[model samples]
Every structure is written in structure tokens, then in C-alpha cells.
Target: MAFLELNDIHKSYFLGKEEFPVLNGIDLQLDRGEFVSILGESGGGKSTLMNIIGGLDRKFTGQVKVDGRQLDHTKEKQLDNYRRGTIGYIYQSYNLISHLNIVENVLVSLDMTTLKGSQRKERAIALLKKVGLGDHLKKRPSQLSGGQKQRVAIARALASDPEIIIADEPTGALDSRNTAEVLKLLDQIAAEGKLVITVTHSQEVANYGTRIVHLTDGQIDGDTRLKPAYPVPQEDQSEFRARPLSAGASYKNAFKHLTFTFWRNSLIMLGTAIGLFAVLLFSGLGNGVNAFIENQINSMVNPNSVTVFKNPTGKKMSSTELQQSMQQFANDPSKLLLTDDQIDHLRDLKHVNKVEPGYQLSTYTVSYNKKNSSGSGIQTWTKAFSDNTIKTGHKPGDNEIVINKNQAIALTSAKNYKKLQGKTVQLTMQWINKKNQPIQITGKLKVVGFSDNAQALAAATNYHTMRQLIEKKNGVTKANYVSVNVTNSIYVKQVAKKIQNLKDNNKYTYGAITVGDILDTINQYVQIAAIVLSAIAGISLVVSALMIIVTMYMSVAERTKEIGILRALGERKKDIRRLFTAESILIGLFSAALALLLAYGFSSLLNHILYKIVKFNIVQISAANIISTVIIALVISFIAALLPARRASRLNPIDALSAD
Candidate 1:
């Protein structure tokens, strides 16, 4: 069998919905180590034949057999491998990656083979030297001459050591002297038991080939052999030479270059980082503030606390009527509130604990002599309540008064103030007379145990219970209801149902809700904040993605020559696509890592300050938030790079090289 075979290959295209044939009935074959040159006029489909042979375009009908493998019927995955391992291609324009050094550019094509680090590096360097680029291994393509760049392109093609080296006008860009040099190099490679095929218009370059074929209108018109051909290798010769690296190595190479490339563009990195920072910071801060509010509300009252108030009576009570109510208050404080009879009935139900009747006294300021401060709240005397203290006085007796710890502290701190431990101080009360005058009292009282009831006061309320105080001063009142604290918060619903089942009239009603409900009601504003912050964060992420698109598109434009170079040097279309995608994924991962670090740093600093003031570490971030941010970054990066990658992969080698 011939080393390579193409039988009646036909390729066509559709322009404006009309069929246009590019190649028709091309029959060609060559044994191994035969140097064959194909000469054709411009647009005569010589390059198209080369493209088909290189496996760059598969839309054709023909039988192409290379070493007994059917090239035309090959699967997509196998074709990728064939391009990576079985063929080496060189183009007329010196296709070299501008961002890569001479050696790195050559090694890029070898990434798909099985070569390891040192070996791969070595093979790439040897090929560079063979192509006369030994001293320019560290130089980028732009730093090299046109002849030197084409030689580097040839070296890159040879890195995989394929059975055939397909060159399309390899010396087209060179001067007479450099053209002779490139032709001699092709002769040498062909002499080394490798099939060298060149398509060119130069007769000088074709004369060095052992055979010459002429193509006219996509058909081979002449074939002449002048030397004995070498035998085609039966074994997989790709493995004997340096193979491309593994998939893992490809990722590593992509990451390494990506790092260098981004760092080289410092301003872009900074912009991306700033955008990511905004997204991270706002989300963290919003979640933190919401959590703090929830903690505060949860601490002050049960998340499940429910207050019941009686529907108001329209007519106002006369002073006489209000006083007569004091006569009935002597029996029990509960009667002034829920009435003792109602309390007795409520307490008999399951899940019902003691029902405490309470009333609030209006806020006030306390003063001794020349010392006054406001913001004092009071609650009705409940036996179970434990949130306040009277520093130097007992509970308010019928004829005396008790002051809060803060008010007592301020009183004694004044200049010329006496140690009023037992000294009589005037308690100026409000609304005492018919004209709402303040009552000055000199009731003497001893300082007893301090009541720890001050903290329970939200702002301040004078919550005095008994009816006698209201009757004497005209400021207090009998409460209309009692708060029944259930024994078990979880069973509050059961207790409410039991109360509902009581035979009381419709005039009596009760309700209970979970602590969760109260928190939801109080923190309803948090939802708005979360949305606002998330949107702000989301905008930044979108900006980051747009930035990525701009950057990658610029990269594709800047590296058009490089993409063409890779395509000509055995890189499949998918491989070119994957390289760009890999670069983008790396960018996203980097930004996400940065966002996480910044979020953690800010969260820690803010949490410390808040904990000192509020006595709670409420600003907590969950794992879901972190995961969500990282996933978002990755998706954005992948999406942003897609268009650029596809554009790069679809670039025609001829057009890409022709671009400035």
C-alpha cells in the first residue's frame, strides 16, 4: 500500500446558496521519505488540497488512507488525535505566537502528545536548532526576521515528528537567499525517512524535491519521481518521536501563560479586582447588617411574643367614673387588667402558665436637687420580671416612690448632693390634680434589693399595675388584658387552641405565633437590602464578564498570527478553542479567589467592631454565599471567553497570516 493515498477527493462550498466546487477528482499517493512539490496558480486549490490533507477541513467526499487508516471516515475524536500525532503542517507566512518565546511556541503544538516536561522541552529545543533558530529560543516572534519566523514555524511543526510534513509555500515569504536556505531544510527533513510535501509556485524550491506534482483546476496533472522512496512505518511512529504533552500539561501551560499575560496587563487586573471587590463587599455587608438586626430583635423579646389589646370604647370616662374604678382595684391587680375572673379561667387551660397583668406608666425624668435626666420607663410590677434595679430605694410603696439605678446615680453625682440613702427626696409626679399638675412627694423609703428590670424597657415606659396609683395621681390605669407566658414555647399553639375552645364569649380573643414570625415581621426590611446588595454585586460581576470579553477579544486580535501558527502546526480546531477557554477559566478562578479573601477580611473587621458594641457576633457568612460567588465567577468567565475562542478557532490560516 502507498504510505498516503487520496482517491477522487471532491470538496465544495455554498456561496449565496449556489454550489461552488473547490477541489474535484484529485488522486495522489506517496511512499514514505519522498519529497513531493505541488505547483499551482493562485486560487487553483493547491492550499485547499493541503488543508484537506492536514485534516483542517473534513467536509468532502473522498477516500483518504494514511497508513491503512481511512482519513475521510475518521471520527471527530480520532481526527483530533490524527492532527495532533500523524501530520505536521507548515504555512508560507511565518505563523508564530507573539506572546510566546521561540521554544515555547514550538512546544505548544506538542501539548497534545504524551511527552513529559524535560523531554518535551528538549525535543522542542532540538527542532528549533535543526531549523536554525537555536540562539533565538527566548525571543518572541515579533523579534525575529520573516525567514527566522517561518523556520520557527517549521520547527514547531516537526515537534510531534509526524510521518508526513505538509508545507504550503514554505519559502514564499523569504528572499532568494532565505528561500534557498528553507528549501535545503525541507530536503534534509525529507532525506531523514519522512515524507516531505510542499505546494509552491517557485520552481527553484520544487527542484530540491525528489518528486514534483502539478495541480490544475483542483486535479493532479503531472507526477514524476526521481528517487527510491523510503518504506512507511507499520508501527505508531508518533510514539517513537517526541509526542505532545498530556491534557494535564495543556492546562498547566494555559495557566502558566495566563498568569503572565494578566500580570502584564496590570490595569485590567486592577479593574477586574475592583469590580469583584464591590460584589463581594456589598453582599457581605448587607447580610451582616440584616443578621445584626435579627439578633437584636431576637434578644429583646421572644421571637414569638404576641400582644393582645382590647378594642377601644368610644366614650371617655369622667373623673368620678375613673375614681370609682379604684374601689374595685383593691381585690386584685388582675381584675384591673384582665379581671381576676378571666385570669382564673385562662390559667385552668393546658399550656397556660401564670397570666401576669401589667400596665405602662408614661416616660419621665427624675430629679433630686439640681440634677435631672429624662428617658425613664416603667413596667407594672410582675413577680417574674427581672430586668431592673432601684439602687438606693425599695419598690414604690403606696406612700413612697422608687427610682431607677441610672436616675439614682445621676442624682448622687451632682455637686452639694447628700448621700440620700435614707434621706427623703421629693418625687414629682404628673397629672395629679384636675389641671394635670405635678405632685411633689416627700415619702421616705429605705434602699432595698435592686430590681433588674431596666433592660427590658424598650426606650422607656412607666408600667405600673395597681389601680390605686392611677386613682391617686391620675396617670396610671387598670390594664384591659394580661400576658400569659406559656410554659413551653413550642406548645404555644396547643395552649392557644385550648383557650380558643373555652366557653368564653366572642368578646374574648387570643392568638399566638412562633418566634420565627416576629423575626420575619421585624426583619422584613432585610429582604429589600439583600436584593439591593445582590443587584449591586451582580452588576459588578457583569462588568467583570464584559471586561473579560473585551480582554479575550483583544487577545484574539493580537494573537491572530499565533492562532494561525497553532492551526498549521497540528492543533485541532477544538484544541485552539480549549486553550482560550482554559485561559478564561483561569481568569475567573483568580478573581473568585480574590473576592473570597477580600470578603473574609472585611467580614472579620466589621464583625469585631460590632461584637464589641452589641455583645454579639452577628455578621456571619454561610457556605452557600461563598459557593455562589465562586460559581458565578466561573460561569461569567466561561461565557465571556466563548465568542473570542470561537472566533480564534474559525480564523482561516491564510487570512490570519495576511493580517498586520
Candidate 2:
């Protein structure tokens, strides 16, 4: 059993059922510590044989045994392990990753081992120092001369401490001095008890090896031994352990590549951030405007109370029918009027603190001395109204009225409005009777105080006085609406629901309305507006995803050779895909961060300007909005990169390495 064996090996290429033999009946045996050179002409099979021995060209028929273990090319993982741990390759073109520094290039091979963190960096530095290029560790491949680049490649090949070093035309691109230097390094590597195999067509390159094997017409023609092989030293087998490739290493590489093209990536991120910013800003604005409207409405009424109206027909009514019913009730109080029994039933309901009967007359007139106002609406005062919503007025007593400031201004001048508070005024009201006949009623009331303008343009009076005046004229004493006050604001919605479910004569006869219901309707419309604006902004994000797809495809095309290099260095197809995917996710994260920053800054400025006008912060961005933005960005970015990543992963290593 030899250290490495190739028995009766045969290889051929096929083109449309035609076969061209590259290697035939080649038998060879080699041991460690030997600098062996396979020499042949350009059309001969020297490179083909080297490829088979290096486990790169596995489609050949042969028994390839290393240290008495047969090589099974059918298993992909086994081949990957063989390439990663058993052999190292040095290409003729000095295929170095352009974005990586010299030290990083070497570390790419060592990253597959268990050596962690600082230990891997130290090993890469040591290998570079051994190759006489220690000071150039931080320099990229393009910054170095051809000789220096070749040295870096050599250092990278030796970083993993493989058993065999396979060099394919390693000195083809070097000058005489550099060639001599590389050959001397190869000699020293062989002397360190490792097999050094060189494949070349030049006699001068082959002469430096201790043994030379000649190939002609796909067969070994001759073999010559120049000196005795060095003795194999004791190997440190414990240092070589199988370790899975690190995803962190791939991400680091992707970050380096992204930063190398920072300006291009920044432009893409800016475009993406603009779309995200628009969505977040519009959503925040909608939230703030809805909140402002809710506050205004809540301040004008008791949120813990619900207003109930009688449904005269005892059935659901259409919008037009409901409007006509309300108008008829205003013109004639007998229509759709609630009785005293109904009010008492509401007061006995659960969570109901008290019930307030209220009447509104849309047709009315008043006379104060010589000046009188017509078309003035009148409302009866209740406990709920006087306790919660009245801003500056005392409860009206019998025959006393409280009018809004606007109504006071309408009747008299602003300066004389204060003096009218204690003055008496004559009130005359007219309405249609139950038989559809017209009727007139007259009464005298004194002005008590002024209420807030939010109570609408209605004159308020005591419930007893309004009822007495109505009954005296045409015998109408029913209330048009009733106010049901709940014990707490939290139970307003529940109580309102119960009131709406109340029935009269086996049909629902009442409708309830709470401040929360009004607010909910308003907020619903606001959310709809926000959604529409966000959808428009999302069109730009679609365009941004297309931009990402185009950019990733371009990156794959530009770095085709780098993809090949990674494949040759024992990276799986999934690893290649993850590299591109990781880069895209990083772009998404950066764009999301930029959008958040811009939204915060703009919201601050808008809030400052709005606070002066509305006395409230009117643009709020919530945590949910931020989280949703980030998730949207990442999902779009990942979907955009999928096609390009799969394309890069499926590339053939040999074909990619051949690409310019």
C-alpha cells in the first residue's frame, strides 16, 4: 500500500456521442516527502492526470486510494471533505478574491477548521510570514506585484495544512527570479515531509523537482529519480478535526464586498428608505388627527352618557325615512315622542345612574322689549347637561333660560350681553297639533346665564316650564329624546348596546348613540385614508425591490470568478446562496434604519409646527409601525435576492474559474 495510488485510470470527454480520451491506463505510486513533477507537452495529459489526483475531476474510472482508503466520488459530502482536508490547490492564474486582503484570503481556507477567532488570524499571519510576504498581509491582490500575488496564493494553499500541495503551472506567469523563488519554496515545502506535485510543460520547471514523470499520448512514457526522497516525519494528527463551515465567516465576507461598493449600495438604500418613510409618516399623521378629533368631541359632552331617541315605526328605517321622521318630530312634538313610562324603564336599567328627559323645539321665537329673534331652537335643561357640559352657566330655574354666547350676541351687542343676563324676555312657540292643525303658545322667561358655544344654538330652560308651556297650548307633553347617564365611562358602550336592544310592542323602538361610537366611526375613516396613502407609497417599494434584483444580478455577474474560488475552496452550494442572501438582508436592515431616522426627524419638526396651532402633538409614530416597516423591508429584500442567489449557487466551479 502506497501513500497515494492511481491504478488503471482512464478519463475521456464526450461531444455528441463522440469520445476523446485524455488519460488511458495510467498507473502511478507516490509517497510523502517527495517533490514529484508530471511533465508533458500542451496536448498531452499532464494537467488532466493532476486534476484526477487532486479530487477535482472525479468522473474518471479508477481506484484512487490515499493511505489505503479508497476514494468514493459518488458521495458529494465525502468529496468536499477530501478537497477541504486532504489536498490544497494553487491555480496558474493566481485566483485571489479581489475584495479580500491578503490575510483574509488565507483565512478563507482556515475558516473551515475548528480554529476560532484569534487563533485563525494568527495562523493566517504565520503562513503569510512563512511565504516572505508578512508585511503585505493587509494589501489586496491588485495592489501587489505578480510575484507577490503568487506568494499570497501559496500562503493561502498552505494555511489549512493539507497532506498534499497540488500546483498546476504555478510558475507560468512569473519572471526568472520569481520563478526561482517559487520553485525554492516548493522544494522547502516538500522537505517538510509533505507531497508536492507540480504539473508543467517546461523542462526547467520540472528539473527542480526530485523526481520527474513524463506523459505522452495519455500514457506515462518515462520516469526518472533525481535524489532519494526525504523521510516522512511524525504528523500532528490531533490538530486536524472535521468542522462545519461557519456562516459568520460568509457574512463577514459579504459585508466586506458591500462596503467596497458603498456609494452604489447607499443610493439603493436611500431609494428604499424613501418608500418606508412615506408609509410611516402618513400612518402617524392619521393617528394624530383622529386622536385630536376625539379629544375635541369628548371635551364637549359626557362620554359616560348615551342619548336615546324613540323610533316611532318600531322598525329599522332607511336614511331618508329616518331624516323625515326627525323633521316631523321637530315640527310636531306628538310624533315619535317618548312617554314617562319609557323614561322610568330606562332609569331602572343596570349601570344607569339617572335618566334626563329632554325636548328640542326647532320652530320658536322670542321677544325682549322691542327686539325679538325668530327661528331660535329651545332645549329643556337636565341634570346630566348642567353637571357635565355646561361651561359657564348655572342651572336654569322655572321660567329662566340660559342661552349660548352666539345666541346672546345675535340678540344684543357684545357689550350689552352681560346686562341681559338678568332681564326678562317673552317667548312664543308655534307647532303643528296631533290633528295636523297649527297652534301657538306664549310664555315669559328671564335670561339666567350663558352656556358654552359647544352646546349648539339652542336656548335652555327648566324641564317643568317647557312642559307646562307645551301642555297649556295644545296638550303635548311627551319628550323627544332622553339622556341616560351611566355610572362610569367604561360602561357607556355596554349600556348603549342594551338601550338599542330595547323593544316596544315586540319591535325595537329605541336607538342609542354614545361618544365612543362616534369616535370609532371617525377613527375608522382615518385608518382607511392611511391605508390608501400607504398603498400608494408601497408602489415605490415594489420599484425598489426590482432595483435590488437588478443590482444583485449585476453583482453575481461581476464576481463570477470569486464564486468559483469559493466553490473550489470547499464551499457548498447553499453556502454560496447564503452569502448573497446575507448581503441583501444587510441592505434591508440599513434601509429600515435610515427610514426610521428620517421619520423621527420629520415627525419632530411637524409636531413642533402643529403644536402652536392645535396645542397638541399631532404626528405620532407607534412601535407597531416601526416593527411592521422592518419586517416589510426584510421580506421584500429576501424575495428580491432569491433568483440571483440561486443562479450564483448553481454555477459550476470549473466553468466559473475559467470565466474572465
Candidate 3:
């Protein structure tokens, strides 16, 4: 049997149910090492026959057998393998990828073989040397002469060492000298025990082959043998080798294309980075603001302690009901006042260091020599104030008070504020009793010092002073609230929980409020605000994704021929899809990296400005935020590329190769 057999092939074109025959009842047989040319005029089915034999046209009815195995054109994968392993096509237009260099173009075919890394590159270089374009291996197709381009095309076709060479109008565009060079190269290919088939219109081109077949209209009209075919070479079967393309090759190809369109890709990345930057910045700002607020609150109060307020109604209440009850108790303090036994019980709880009784008078008036202040509150504590920065004198003793600097200025006038310390002041306090009667208490206290600006409008003293005054006026010394100090800050929450569950009268529940609780509420609001702002920023990400989709579709349209070339080189459908998808992922990665860099720079500058004013770093970007930004970018890019990648993979190689 001949090495290749085309038996009774029939092909046609259809237009609206009308059949137009192109090739009818064509039968041919050829063996290895035979240079055969199909000579024909225009519209004589020369190109159509070449397409059928090259595995580019699979819709025809034919039996094509090569090396005793029948070709199943209906199976796309089998056709792909045949095109990649058995046939090499040299086109009239020299369909070389414009972005790739000469040697890189050859590597496109060799990449499909078992040769890896430097071996594949060496093979490509060797093939280019054979075609006499070795010195121009790094030049692009645009930079090469027409003859050089054709030589590079020949080198690429032979890169994978296929068994057959198909030249379709190979010299149609070349000058006489270059035409002779290409024809001589074809003769050399055939001499190496390979089948060489040329399709042409000129008799001079046909004469270069050993055999000539004339086709007047679809059917073969004549056949002539000029010289005997070269004898087939005897080589070890183990020498034959090929392998599938690797992922590294795909990524390399993708990187080349991306760099070729650097400016365009950079524009898309900038848009995407803007969206990610907004999200990351706002998230970091929210974190920083929360931390600052917690730090401020902790500085003012003891983080290792909780303040317990007696429940007013001796029953469970909703927050709203609790607020109303607390308001009522505030107006009439006697109803919610804690007794000695309750304070002692709180001190015995686990993790509790001690319980200190405290009194707070919200409606108080302080007067010193006709300079008076009303609506000023007074608080007495058991623990010494460590956070307070006193401007003069010291913390309050049992009979002394430390007034806020602002309040002292308001009471004594700003000019006399410094001299007011150590002076006696009269305090008058009033509240409604449990019997629904108004009560008033008055006491004289000596001012000890002025606190720093943080303490807004309150005065503080030791608990003994407030207790003695309360007993003298109301005839009852009941604690309004008790401060329960835990052994360590780490146990604050646990101790607070126990204190909140403690009952004052075995019926009323106590409420425990810690510095951490207030900070948590503030942090919750800050996070909500951040999320809302980031969501607004995320609107731009949607637009960016749409831009990526449009860009990928444009890439598919622009590289349609390149796609066909890759498919012809034995790439699977998924491989083509992966190539495009990998490009999108690279875009996402670039955008994410740019966004992170911009966010870091902006945060650093903002923190520098803020630290001067607030004495703290106010922008904190976390690792998790950076990771989330990257993952979001990748997911969005992957989703955007899906349709374009799928469309590119599904394209028909013949149609794509023919596209303008």
C-alpha cells in the first residue's frame, strides 16, 4: 500500500439547499520521498484539495489513509493529531505570528514535542539554520524580507519533524530568485524520505517536483512521472519522539502577547487597581479609627474593671425599658441605691480584686466667692486616678476635690483658674426621693488640683468625702454604683459577665458596663461605615470587570489567526481557553499588586500627617485585607474572561486561518 491514499474523494459547497460540487471522484496514491505537484488553473479545486489533505477541511466524504491507518476526519481530536504529527503546511501568505520572533515562531511548533527547556530552543535554532535564516532568528516577521519570511515559515513547518509537507501556492508571492530557493528547499525536504505535495498554477513550479498531476476541473485529467522517487531511509523506531506542550510554554506565550500590548494592558490594570485601592484603604481606616477610639477610652477608664449599676425595677427589662428605668433612678437615686451587703457580695466573686462604692451627682452646683457653676457633676472613686495629668496640686484626698480644668475655668473665670486650687468651694446637690419629694444637700469641699483637658466637666474626690456628705444630708448613705476591679485586664470580660448576672436583692439584676463594651459599640458603627464606603468604591470594580471582558473579546478578535495556528500545532480546546484565561489572571495579579502598593503609600503618608496631630498611626492595613483584594481581583478577572476564552476555543481553525 502507498504511504498515503486518497480514494474516491468527493466534496461540495452548500448555499440554501443548493449543492455546488467542488471535487468529484478524485483518487490518488503517493509514497514517501515523492515530490508531487497538483497543477491547476483558477477555480480548479487545487486549494480545496490541499485543505482536505492537510486535515483543515473535515466535512468532505473521503477515505484518507496514511501508513495503513485510515484518517477519521469526523473526529476533531484525531484530525488535530494528524495535522500536528503527520503534515506541515506552508501557506502562500506565510501566516507567521507577527508578535513572535523568527526562532520563537519555530518554537511554537517544537513546543508540542517531548523536547523541553533548552532542548526545544536548540531544535528551533537548528531548524532556522537549515532554512538559511539562522542569523535573523531574533527578528520579527515585519522586519524580515518576503523571502526571509517564507524561509522562516518553512523552518516552522519542519520544526516538529512531521512526515509530510504541504505547500499551497508557496512561491505565489516571491520573486524569481526567492521562488527558486523555496522550491529547492522543498526538494531537499522530499529527499529526506518525506512526502512533499505542492499546489500551484504555473508549470515552472510543477516541474520542480518528481511527479505532476494536472487537474482541469476538480477531476485529475493527466498524470506524468518525471524521476524515480528517493528510497525510504531505515532508522530506528525509538528515535521518533513528540510530547504534549507544557504549562510553562503556555505562560511564556501569554507573557509575550501581554508585553506586546503593554500600554493597553496597563490601562486596564490601573482601572482595576483604583477599585481595589478604595476597598483596602477604607478597610484600613476603619480598623485604625476603632483602635484609636479604644485606646482613648482605655486611657480614661480602667480596662481591668467594670462599673455595676443596680437594676431599678427588680426584674428583667429590655434595653429601652432599662434605659427608662435608669433615667427614673437618675432622677430619684434612693430607689436604685446599692446596700453594703450587695457591694460585699460583688467583692467575693471570682476574678474580682475589690469592689469600691461610688456616688455620682449629675445635678450639682459649685460656688466659690460668687463665681458659680451649675449642671456640673461630681464623682467619687476608690482607686487613685493614674491617667489624669494634673496641672497643679495632686489627686483628690478624702476631703478634697480635683475639678476638670475646663470646669474650673468656667467656675472661677479663666484668669483666676490657677489660684483656685486649695480654696474651699460650696457644693449643692438636689434629687427626687423615693417618696416623690424633692431633696437638697449641701457640702463644702476644698479644690485639690485641676485635671488635664480630657476630663470634660466633672470633679472627682475620694469616696469617703461623698459618703459623709450624703449621710449628713439625706440620713442614708447608699451606694449608687460600685466599681468592681478584676485581677487582670484579660479577665475583665469574664468578671463583667459574672457581675451582670449578680442580683442585688435576689430579684433585680445588675448591669455591668466595661470600657471594652463601649469601645466595641463604637467599633461596630465604624465597621458598618467602612463597609458602606467600600461598597460604593466597589461599583467601579464592576465597571472594570466589564472593561476586561471587552478587552479580552477584542484580544480574541485580533489574534484569531494566532489561535488557529496554535490549534493546528496540536493544542487542545482547553489549552486555547487556558491561554486566554491565564492572560486575564495576569491582568488581575498586576492590578492587585498595584493596588496594594498604592494603598501602602497612601497609608504611610496619611499616617505621617495624622501622627503629628493625634499621636497615633491612624491607618492600619492588615494582611487579610491584602489577600482578600487579590482573591477578589482574580475571581472577577476569571469571570470576565470566560465568554471570550470559550469563543476563542470554539473557533474553526480553517475559518480563522483565512480571516483578514
Point out the higher-scoring one by TM-score: 1 or 3: 3
lDDT of each: 0.66, 0.83, 0.84
RMSD of each: 7.8, 4.1, 3.2
Mind sharing the TM-score for model 1? 0.72
TM-score of each: 0.72, 0.86, 0.90
Tens digit of per-residue lDDT, candidate 1, span 1-660: 887899989988898999988888998887777899988788888888887887766778998899977875456556566777778877776666666788887778776566767877898999998887788888988899988988987887787877789898998888988888888888788777788889998777777889989888878888877666655445553554434345566567677678668675455545565666666666666666777766654554543333322222212332233334434443333333444565566666666556666554345554566665454444444433323333333444443444555555667854423354554444333323334344432122332323333554422222332355456555424454455666776876566445543444543333233344445654567767766776875776777788889988988898787676666555656767778888888888787777778778877887788888877655566677778777877788899989999999899764675678
Best by TM-score: 3
Alpha carbon deviation, residue 606, candidate 1 (Å): 6.9
Encode model 2's per-residue lDDT on 399-438: one tens digit a residue. 8987776656667877777677888888887655557577
Candidate 2, position 403, lDDT: 71
Better of 1 and 2 by lDDT: 2
- The parts of candidate 3 lying over 4 Å away from their true place are 237-244, 311-335, 374-378, 382-394, 413-419, 431-438, 449-457, 500-508
What is the Å distance of residue 85 in model 1 from its true position?
A: 2.7
Q: Give model 3 RMSD, 1 decimal.
A: 3.2
- For all candidates, what are the clash counts? 25, 0, 1
Which candidate gets the maximum lDDT versus the true structure?
3
